[model samples]
Every structure is written in structure tokens, then in C-alpha cells.
Target chain A: MTSETPAALAKAAERPRPALSMSTGRAGDRIFAGLSRGSGLVILAIMAAIAVFLVWKAIPALQDDKANFLTSQEWNPDGAPAKFGIAQLVFGTLMTSVLALVMAVPVAVGIALFITYYAPRRLAGVMAYLVDLLAAVPSIVYGLWGLNFLVTKMTGVSGFLNSYFGWIPLFGGSETGGRTILTAAIVLAIMILPIISAITREVFVQVPHAHVEAALALGATRWEMIRMSVLPFGRSGMVSAAMLGLGRALGETIAVAMVLSTTAGIDWHILKDGGNTFAANIANTFAMSGPTGRSALIASGLVLFVITLLVNVGARAVVARRKEFS
Target chain B: MAKRIEVSGLHAYYGGTHAIEDISMTIEPRSVTAFIGPSGCGKSTFLRTLNRMHEVIPGARVEGKVMLDDEDLYDSSVDPVAVRRVVGMVFQRPNPFPTMSIYDNVAAGLKLNGVRGKRRLDEIVEESLRGANLWNEVKDRLGKPGAGLSGGQQQRLCIARAIAVQPQVLLMDEPCSALDPISTLAIEDLIGKLKSQYTIVIVTHNMQQAARVSDRTAFFNIAGTGKPGKLIEIDDTSKIFTNPEQKGTEDYITGRFG
Candidate 1:
């Protein structure tokens, strides 16, 4: 169209421009989307395959069982007709992990707060690095240290608790053996402290500066400011971090097996020896097990997996209900 | 209960860098005073020093005499937390406690100060919400999350939260800068009402806002980049707007310079 011709200009504007020849960007996007979908499907496939294999192997052993798998506090999977139950192991797993969480979470949160708010500026970085280093220490090393070193030191402490706090059923055992569920829980607590603390630190750090200022401006003490601003903002994140720590506590094998004096009976006494966990049982028994015993261990592993999954889902749901704040 | 502020030889620093230098002024009780300055001139920093909020930052500190009546706020035995309780502050952006209900957000300060009776908390929360002009909109939804409110409403909620503690002096650091014009007007009106009961100090980049809301105005200036900010002039808002005593104040008010 000529430059001065208004009608011709309008017509030209209405016409679509020619398309570019290259379509690589669109092709790249499609390929990337497909790759991500494929990866997700691969994870699903692996999980399903594991579930199916566990069920396939476990059914025959379960069918031959002479006792109730959910109630009987005995493990004789290699016995004639395979007589075993996960009741005791399940109790041990839950009790130890819950105790560990009860012990570690508060301390972890405190350490996180100290690092984020209370520590000298130069020291905070060094302290955070040390906690990270603690997390990276091998579980096997922890197992060795927990069994060799802590078990001995804990005897005196266990004796003290039994003397002063033994009125509670959990700590009401006559015996004061340090090789007990409490010891295992204590070790697990130390092992998981860094994981929970580090995540909580990040969450605390992410609390908006404005909210903290709001609390401080309203005459909040440092601890009170943390309570009003940092704690609420990081609650969901802390729950998720605790859940992750719980997952590790549940699935932990070498350290729990090494520290816990395994017993097949369900006992409420936390101070005395006698407890078993799904992962610890599997780890301790797998080496000497026959085919059916192996399948039984696999079944126990399946239950542990489901329990961890349920814990994660439950934590996620709790976090989701508080999503409005986020 | 309102209290007048008398600041003298105030110097604030962030690490080694001086932020606000040798600022001194008297803020009358039951009136609004506005501090107007360009970006990075530390008007906000000086405002924070009145209540000891500046030291919350790592390596940030203030050296000065901030006299609230006869009490020296920076005295060795004076707790910063108590100073803050007496001199409340509102921030540039609305920062309602995200996890709390509107009711809980308003009651947060009282709870911190050990007010536990449910009846007392309810009374103070209602009164403070009314004081911030937020009661009518949020009264029916007291259980709703404070963060669920609109930006303007959230800012008012923050104000309600501050006033719930019954501070004598209220500091607002560009409280309406993030709001739309209509919301800004609403807050300006609220400030005018609030001035009758509290000694109010506000920092604003908008010179017209200072003229519109403040009874007295202080102009802050920096010589160059990285230089500490200085208070150039303080006078009646009307006189400062029409005919300033200092050339820098006149230049800034006339938009010839910052």
C-alpha cells in the first residue's frame, strides 16, 4: 500500500503477516512436556512394580501362617507353617519414632531459632554448617557410635529416669538396661535432629520480614516475636519436615537394628530391653531367612512403606488445611 | 494516653555506615508529624529508633536520646520491648499475621503483654478495630484469616493490631505507599482521626501526603549517595508548604530537588 493511502493501509493492517519457517521452539516444548510426563510415569511404574512383587511373594507365606498377622506378638516365619505377627514390631516402630519426634522436634526448632535469630551473626553460618555436616554423617557410622558409645553412657541416665520418672508406665520397668527402646529412640532423635532443624531453619528464615517487624513493633520479646511470627508462619513447613524425619525414623535400619535389643513381645516398658521395628527386623532377619522368611520380611517392608506413605499423606492434609495463610 | 517525643543528637547506623545523622526534633502530643525524604535518606530508620525497632536488624543500631516525656527510651535499664509497647509502629506494607484470625491478630499484642481474660481481649479487640475504621467491614468475619483481607483492609488490620496494645505514640512508615489512591485517602482520613488520641509520626515520599495529613512537617536530605541523611527543616505544615525556611526544603517541596 502507498504511504498516504489510508484505505490501503487499513487493508494491509487487516492482513496476517507471513508465519516464520522455524517451529523448533514448539517442538522443544512438546518434547520437554513429554519427557516430564514419561519421568512421572516411570516413578509410578516402579512403585506399582514394587507393590505387586511384595504382594506376590508375601501371599503364599501369609496363607500358610498359623497365627493372626495383625495381633500375635511373635515372629517365627521360618517355623513349620510360618507362625508370625507384626504387632510387636509395629508397636516398637511407632513408639520409638514418636518418642524420637517428641524429643528432637523441640530441640531442633530451638536450634533453628537460635541460628536464625539469637546466634551472633558470624557464628550462625558456622553453626548451620555443622548441623548440615551432622546430617551428612553416614547412618552406619551413627549405628556404630550409638551402639558402642551412647549405649554405655545412657545407662546412667536411664537409671536416673527410672528412679525419678518411673511412675509412668512407659518408663516403669524394674530393669535399667540401657539397651532398650528408649536408647534406640534417643539415637534416632540425634540422627534426625539435623534434618528437622535444617528444614525448620529455612522455614523460619522465610518468615516475611514485615511480619517479624509487626511483632517486634507490638512490643514482642525475641522469644515472643518468634512465637507470634516465626512459629505460625513456619508451622506447616515444620510439620512437613517432622513428617520427613518420621519417615526416616520409620525406615531406618542399620542404626535401629544395631542399637535396639530385639524382642518379639509387645512391652510398654521403654527402659528395659525388648522391642523390634519393621525395618530393624527385616535387616536383622534377612541374612538367615529362608524363601518364606524372606517373603515375610518383604511383607513387613510393605507395611512400613504404607505406614510412611500414610504419615506423609496425613501431614500433607494437615498442611493443606492451613493453605489459606500460605 | 498520648506522649510527646523529644529526640536530640540522634545517630543511626547499619554496620559501619551511618544512615541518619544528628537528627533532632520535638513531636507534639496529639498531633501528626510527617517526615518526608527521598529514597535511602533514612527517614524510616529514624522513625524506627524512637521505639528501638532499628536494632532488630543485624548490626544495626542507634545512638541518641529519644525522650518520651521524662523517660529516656535508650537508657540502659529501659527495655526495648517496653519502649515498643509504648510506641507502636505500622509498616510500609500490610503485614497481618498470616496464620491468625482477624480477631487473633488484633489480640496478639495484648496476649503478649499477659492479658488473658477473654472478656478483656474481646473488648480491646473490638475497640481497636473500631479505632482503625476496620470494625464495620470485618466485624461479622472475625474468625476469618487476617491475610484473606484486601491490601487496604489488611493495613487497617495491622493498625488495629498495633492500637490494641494502647501505645502512646504511633509510628507509620509510608503506611499508604503501597495502596491505591482511594485506599490512601481512607488511611489519610483514619490518620486524621487517630491524631486526636496518639502522637503520630509518618514517613512519606509523597510531599502532598505530608501536606495533607501532618500538622508539622520535617524535610530530610542527603548530600550525596552513601551519605547519612540529615533533617533539613521542621515547621508548621502550612508554612513548610507555602514558604520554607531552608533552600533545600523549598527545593524538595517544589520538586526542583530531593
Candidate 2:
């Protein structure tokens, strides 16, 4: 009777099931799958909530009389009429990120390769463990260190660059010293180095030992093996590593706030003087704002949120491809 | 034809484990030397020592002299890199570089040793593929990824990559253990051809492969070995297989012990 009723039972079971719980699988398995899928929905809901809250809070400033929401740069969101434009703030965000990437990418890739290959085997392992430890170090500590030691040391570096390559506008090499985009970028490089290096090292180490051996058997030297086999094998990993590092550098608030002197302007000379960043502006002025000012600042946060989200998506895509090689 | 690889008082240790002990044998330079022993009897360890690959692992050390025409390989001042460049190796599994094209795989050794001219690299790649007898099947697909090749082709490509360096000695560690019989035959034929220009030392667990390819066979044994592995006998391959000098060797080759 059981065998004869198999098809009938299957047909009966094909009826639309309830989403809550009507399955043969354990509560744990079903719960895990549900949680994994539902986590995305949860994140989307939170993001939507934040956006709605921001728009509601920003309503007065968005409808203000002196200027539209995004056109003016005066940033007096609560002085009688209350006016501000994000051109300068947007410019600062783009400049700081661009400067950070230029400074960080090469050093990160180099450190990753060196940590993976050149450091003595025992030393390399220890160094890698330490870099991973560095990733866990609080952002505030890095800010404190950058403010105290990095700024002072960077002043001397600015003077030296002024003596050497002052003609290049990016390094106008001005004695205004190094608290500028250039110095902030250097500090950001140090912070991001550990991240990119750790990922690249992990990826390089995973390069099939067989390929490294094949290269060695082919008379390739250690360096040559890394260049031809390990580096190429980990190319996608390196790109994702760079993008992850850029994401961190873009969103870093405390360190950039502490290190950069808050001046407002768009100067192409990265070494000219300290400049404001979106994160720095938020951290610096949150205490002095009224309701309208608070809403304007929150809108700035929205910009940073969108920027970081894009960086994260790009990094995830690169990482997705990196996994394909395995 | 530079047909001798002399080993004297060879002892190897994996950080005091005493893996290979007091092993001494002279292998035919242009003929295959098969070291047949039980699983733990140091056959692979002994093979690696021939090319200084034994030292790749941390704390793995060898205390003995292996010579190719009187140059001491383990001498304190001798560079293992130079020794390896002269004595190439093929591991048990095929390990073609996944990132490179088939042409690049064959040309890797030449380019790394400062052979940079495009013309020369191109020529050597073709020569090596032909030498390993893989050129016919892969000649049309030299630009394709090397990892795309079939298992047999990949192993052959590895062989091509090894011999590309033009080493005087070839050390293979169970080269066919990871391949099908058809690929094994292809490698065997390539090995026969390689013997003209290279001295060959191979370690194998397959008794039939030993009988089929090698000219000299060295039988390793552990005698009540809470001790180290020691060489039991070394002789012409036919003699060792047909009538080994040691009873242990006889038992082992006749499908008795391992």
C-alpha cells in the first residue's frame, strides 16, 4: 500500500507550503537557510530606514529659501536663512580618497609580496600574524599615533620634498608641512597596508605549490617564481585586496580627522596644506550644529555611505572572481 | 657520455629522525636508477637528496656527498640552486603553472636563466615540447592555458619544463604513480629518449615499471629498523630483479614484503 500510494503522496505534498515551518528538514537547517537569506532583507530594511530618517530630518534644509539642497558651498545651515553647498565637501571626499589610493596601493602590494615571500620563513610567519593583529587594532589608536608621531615626522619629510621635487604641483613641496592630503594619505597607507598585505599574502600562499615547483624545476629563481607564477596566479586577489584597502581608507574618520588640519578649499597640490574630509567634517562639527545643521551633516553621511557601498560592491566582485581560480 | 652519478656515505635526517642512513651507490649516468623500498623506507627521501630537494622542508638535512663527475653536491660551499639547475626534478604529480600558456610553460626555464630574446625563447619552447614528445598534440595550442591539458599531457609538459633547463641529471619521484598507464608509457618513452643527454634517478613502487625501464636498480631495506634505512643491494636491473644479492631484496622484488 505504501509503494502504491507514493505518487499520490508526492502529489499531495506538492501543495503550496507555508513559509514559516512545514518541512522535513530540521529546525536548525531550515533556520540557517532562512537566516542567510533573511539577513539581506534585514540589511536592506535598515538601510531604507536610515534613508527615510535622513530625508525626514533633512526636509527643512532641502526646502530652504537661499539655495537648493546641493548647489551652494556656504555651509551656514543655521545662520538666519541657513545655506550650504556640498561642492567643496564632495571635492574633499574625492580628493582624499584619490590621494589615499595613490599612496596606499603600491606600498600595500609591495608589503604583501615581501611579507609573503622575502621575510625569513619563520620571521615571515610571525610578521603575517602581527599584520593580522594590526588589522584588529582600534581605529582611534591609529588616530592618536598619527596625530602625535606621524604629523611631527611628516613635517620633516615635507621640508625634504620641498627641497627635492617642489616644482611638481601634487608635491608642490610647500613648507606648509605635511598635515595635508599627502600626509593624511601616507597615514592612511600605513593603516591600509596591513589589510591589503594580509589578503595578498594569503592569496599568494594559496597559489598551488605545484605551480611554484614547476617554475623552480624550470630554472626560475625564487624572485622569478613569484613574478611568473605566484603573482600572476594571485592577480585577481591583489585587485580585490587593493579595493578592500581603498574602502577602509575612504571611510576612515578618526585618523583623518585627527591628522588633517580642517581648512576649506580645493587645491590640487596634495602637499600644500591640510584640508577637510567628509568624515573629518562630520566628526569635527557634529557638536556645533542645530536641527538643520544636524540634518545637513546626516546628508553628508549619506554621501559617505553610498561611496563606501560602491567600494564594497566593487571589492566583492573582484573577490568573487578571485575564488574562481581555486 | 657522462654516464655516472656517484654517491658515498649518504645519510639524511629529518631533524634527528635519521631517514636515510649510510646509503652508498653509483648509478648509471645515462640510465634509469630505480630505488624500490617499502612505504617508509626512504626511497623518495633518497631521490630528493640527489637534487638537493631534500632540504626544501625545514630541518630536513643531508650529510653525505653526491657527485656528478667529481663535484661535491653537499659540500658546505656548494649552492643547492646551482645543483638543482644542473639536476632537474619531476614530482609525483603534474604541476603545470596554471597562469601561463603552454608555450610559456615550456619556455619558463630559458627565460628565467636570462634567456630573454623572443626568438630564442620561442625556439627553446618548441625544442623542449618536441624533446618531451608533447609538441605534436600541443603544438597547435601553444597559446592555450597549460592547465587545460589532459593529465598525461600535463605530466609530459612538466617533463618538458624540467628538461628545458638542460640539466645533466633528472630526478623523478614516482613520476607515473599519479598517471594512467597510457600516460605512463608516454613518460617512459620520453625517459628513454632523455637518457641520451641526462643521467636519470627514479624512485618507484611499481615493480613492473622498475623491470621495464631502469638499467640499474638499488634496493633499500630496514633491518630490524628501530633504526635508519640502509641500501641492501645495487646492481644491473636484470640481475637485481632475476637474482638479487640480498635475500631481503629477493623477497621484496618477488612480491613478498613490499
Candidate 3:
């Protein structure tokens, strides 16, 4: 009987069984799968349509341009020759965003660490809510606040930088008014701070408990534990967070328009006035420009879109590479 | 060098929930002492209290007097970080810092404690890995990420990391529970070797492991669910296995009940 049992089990194992269907499963499962797939395709379709639209509109403005579209510092798309370029706008966008990133990343990481490791439970919850609340505040309100309040307060700070650090080229030049690239960058830093910290806090919170205990058991102090465990684990996350903040800073429109005094050329002296970003330029000029000028604005918009896309892609690559080891 | 541990009237709690009742015992220097208990009986918690690691959990606190030879571990003047340096730990699951290389994982404690000089770090890393019985297997790939190692190797790497700082006491909370039988045997052998240099306190649910490795054995048990865990008896490994004084301890060792 025992010998026959093996053969019987073998026969049972070899017998054909009904296949478990996915698409042909219950009606609910099929409907859910279709809805999810349709949602994903809709997003892809919308992204493609936007890209096509930007390219179609930008081509006409490029054809009508008299000056080098990429290199020229002038913006005169409505002129008889319709000469215009994005050099100044590109420079401003990159400069302000990079500056904001440099200023905000350290503070954001500090705040994240504070929220995760240092604060009392009640205080941590309140602080986290407040940071998220900062992100939800309207950009126009920030623009108005920057123009009416923050700009007035930045004069002393700019003066301090210009005087003490005047030998440094970026901090040189005696432009008196507070409406400068530095001020705009500061505003952008404040605007992006919450988002960077929020994402960084989430990443730090997800650091494996075992890894943390390992560090602590190694006799690591609070700061050392953060340096050894938290920071290394969250390195890629912090990079992505900074990149996201950079994207926001680059595309910020009404705030930069309201805060910055736009000009036609790049200004190396960030402490001085006169820098304009692509979004700020477009927001300030789209209504005043003719049809060709509107196309020119869209062309600049296309450049901004491409730059943001590249930044996001680069961030994803960095995160994906680090995910293997982590 | 190993230091004797004297724990007296230790009681631990997490928030309002009492986890472990008053427990007292002396752990000898340069010997293996195993804590055996059922699940949720606080054998692990009692081990953590030896190194003041029990309080790492939020809302978890301990009231106890743990003395490492002449020094009281919970003294107001003693920093927990300093205590941990003197008393290291190895967890159940291997946790070699995922971002660090094997060499860095071993040298992490030394580097963080401000020990400079590449030659010194290299010497210590080699010594620690050799002490943990993992040097030959991992010597060629010291620069590789620690997480890439097999499970048993990773646990040994964690042991190497724990010993790199030359802690006086080593706490193992079910260190071999996650390994295969062969890996478990390897760790058991390593534990036998390690006890000669450091005071080893291990918590295990496996009775055979306790009998094989420990010089003395402690059994902890709870009255029932929601009741605090208590140390039922502690004695030489031979006596505890052959003839325990407490009925509960005998019943436990005989596998009559948990």
C-alpha cells in the first residue's frame, strides 16, 4: 500500500489542472485592471500631446528668428526682423535654481533630521504638518509676500554680502535696491524648503530599524548615528528631493515675476539687480506680445519643459542606481 | 577583556505595559551564559538591559542596577553611547550597514570614535574579522558591499563589526535563529570560541543551542498572557538540563510546556 501511494501521488501531481486566469478572471478584477491600465495610458497620452504641442508651436518662432535663438541675449520677437534668444533667461533660470538648491538642501536635511530624530512626538507631528502646510500655500501669496515684505527686508542682507564679501565676484557690485537675483533665489529657497524637507523626512523615517540599531549599538552618538546610518541611507532620496526642489525653482513664474526686476542680459553679480528666468519672462510678456512673440514665449517654455524633464530623469537614474545596493 | 555583569531587581516596561518583572542574576566573565524562554517572555528584553539597549524603544524604560564589575551601567554620569562601546550587541537578523563595504562595516565603530590612520584601521578590521572566524571567506572582497554576502557570512560580518571596538561584553539576541542548520552550527562554534575573550550573553528559544554553548543557563517564563516575564531559575548548564530546582524550569527543559 505504501509503495502504491508514491505512484498515486506522482499521478496526481502530473494531472492537468485548471489555469488561473488574470484577464479572464472575475468581473471585478477585470474592471479594476482595465481602469488602472487606462489611467496609466491616459497619463502617457497627455504627456505626449503636450510635448507635440510645444514642438509644433516652437518651430514657427524658430523659423522667424533673425538672431541666434539659443545664444542671443535680446528679446525682440515682435520687431521687424523678430530677433530673440533665451541665453539670459536660461542663465537666470539655472542660476536661481542652483543657488536655491545650494541654500535649501542643507537646511531641508537639517529640518528633516530634527523632525525624525530629535523632536518630541507631539512637536514632530506639528512640525511635519506645518512643513506640509507650507507647501500647500499659494505661490501668488508667496509672490505678494516676497514683493511687499521680503524684498524690503533683504536690503541689509544684500548690503552685508556686498560689503564684507565684495572681493568675491558674485557678491560684488553696489546695486542698492533689494530686487536682485540673490533675493529672488532666497525666496525660491524658502518656497522649495518644505517640499525638500517633506520628502527627505519620509526617506529618513523609512531607514531600516535594524541599521539604526546597529549604529546605536556601535556606540554612535546621535549626530554620528545620523551621519553613519541616516544620511548614507537617504543619500539618493535627498538627491531626488533636491532635484524636485530645483524643478520647482526653475519653473516658478508669478513669484519670480513679482520679485525680480527683469533685464535683457545675464548679470554675474547676483547681489546686484537684473536677472530674468524663462517662466518669469513669459509670465511678464505673454499678454503684451504679438502672435510671433507668443510663439517665442512657447519656445522658451519648451526649453524650460525639456530642462525640467532632464533634471527629473537624471534624478530617477541616480535613485535607481543606488536602489541596487540599498 | 571580559567583565562580569551583575544585574539586580531589573524591571522593564513599555508605556503602561509591564514587559518584565524583577530579575536578578550574575553573568561571569569570559563565559557563555544563555537566556532561554518562550516567545514574548522577555528573555531578549533582559539581555538588552545588560547593555542598556532596552530603552532604545520609545516608551520603553527599565528600572535596574546593572554593574559591569565595579561600575554601575545606569549611573547618571555614564553615557549610554559609552556604555554601548564597552558592551556591544549582535541582533537576530544580520544588519551590516547596507551602504558600507565589508572593511568599512568592521571599521565603522573605530572610525566614528575618531581613530585615524589607514594602517591602524586595516589591522583592526583584519583582527576583528579573524576573531569572528570570517576573515578567510571575505578577505579577498573586503571592498564589496557588506549586504552582498550570504546570510551566515553577513551575520559573521555583523559579529566582526560588534567586536571591532573590543567591547567588554557581547550580547546576542537569537543571533542564529535566522540561519540554516549549517550556519547555525558555524555560529555555535564561533560562540564557543568567542566566550574565551568576551563575556557572552545570548538569548535563544532553541534548547539544544543553550545546552551546547552556554556555561550557565537562565530560563524565563510568564504566569500567563498579559503577565510580566520572570526569571524562573539560573544555574550551571549541566544542572539546569539534568535537574532543575524549579518545577517550571524542569517542565520547560523537558518540553512538557513552554
In model 3, what is the error at residue A180, expressed in angstroms? 0.7
Model 3 C-alpha lDDT per residue in residues A1-326, reported as the tens digit of each score: 88899999999999988776634557888899999999999999999999999999989989999999999999999999999999999999999999999999999999999999999899999999999999999999989999999888887788988889999999987685688898889889999999999999999999999989999999999899998999999999999999999989999999999999887797799977779999999999999999999999999999999999999898889889877865
| Candidates sorted by TM-score, best first | 3, 1, 2
Taking the tens digit of each residue's C-alpha lDDT, what string does model 2 give over A1-326?
Answer: 77879899889999987787666669889899999989989999998998788767666666763665555556777777877767667776677777777777777677778876677678877878887888888888988888899888888887777778788777674445758777788778778878888888888878887777666665566788788888898888888888888888878899889888877656676666657777888898989998878878887777777888898899899888767666
First chain TM-score for all predictions: 0.91, 0.84, 0.91
| B1-258: candidate 2 lDDT, tens digit per residue | 434788999999998799989988888777888889887788888988887878866689999788888788888898777777888899999888887899987777777677888888888888999999999999899999998999889989988988887888888989999999999999998888888888888889898898888888888878655578889998999999898888899999887873
Give the number of the best model, judged by DockQ. 1
Task: Give interface RMSD for all predictions.
Answer: 0.6, 1.5, 0.6
- Candidate ranking under DockQ, highest first, comes to 1, 3, 2
- Candidate 3, superposed: residue stretches over 4 Å from native: A1-25
Write down the C-alpha DockQ for each prediction.
Answer: 0.81, 0.46, 0.80
Model 1 has a clash total of 0
Cα lDDT for residue B121, candidate 1: 92
Which regions in candidate 1 have their CA more than 4 angstroms from the true location?
A1-27
* lDDT tens digits by residue: candidate 1, A1-326: 46679988889999987678856588889999999999999999999998899888888888888999889898999998689999998999999999999999999999999999999988999999999999999999999998999889888888998999999878787888878899999889988999999999999999999889989999999889989989988988899889989988988889999998897798898988769999999999999999889888888888888999999898788678767556
| Candidate number that wins on DockQ, 1 or 3 | 1
Give residue A322's lDDT in candidate 1 (0 to 100).
65
- Clashing residue pairs in candidate 3 are none
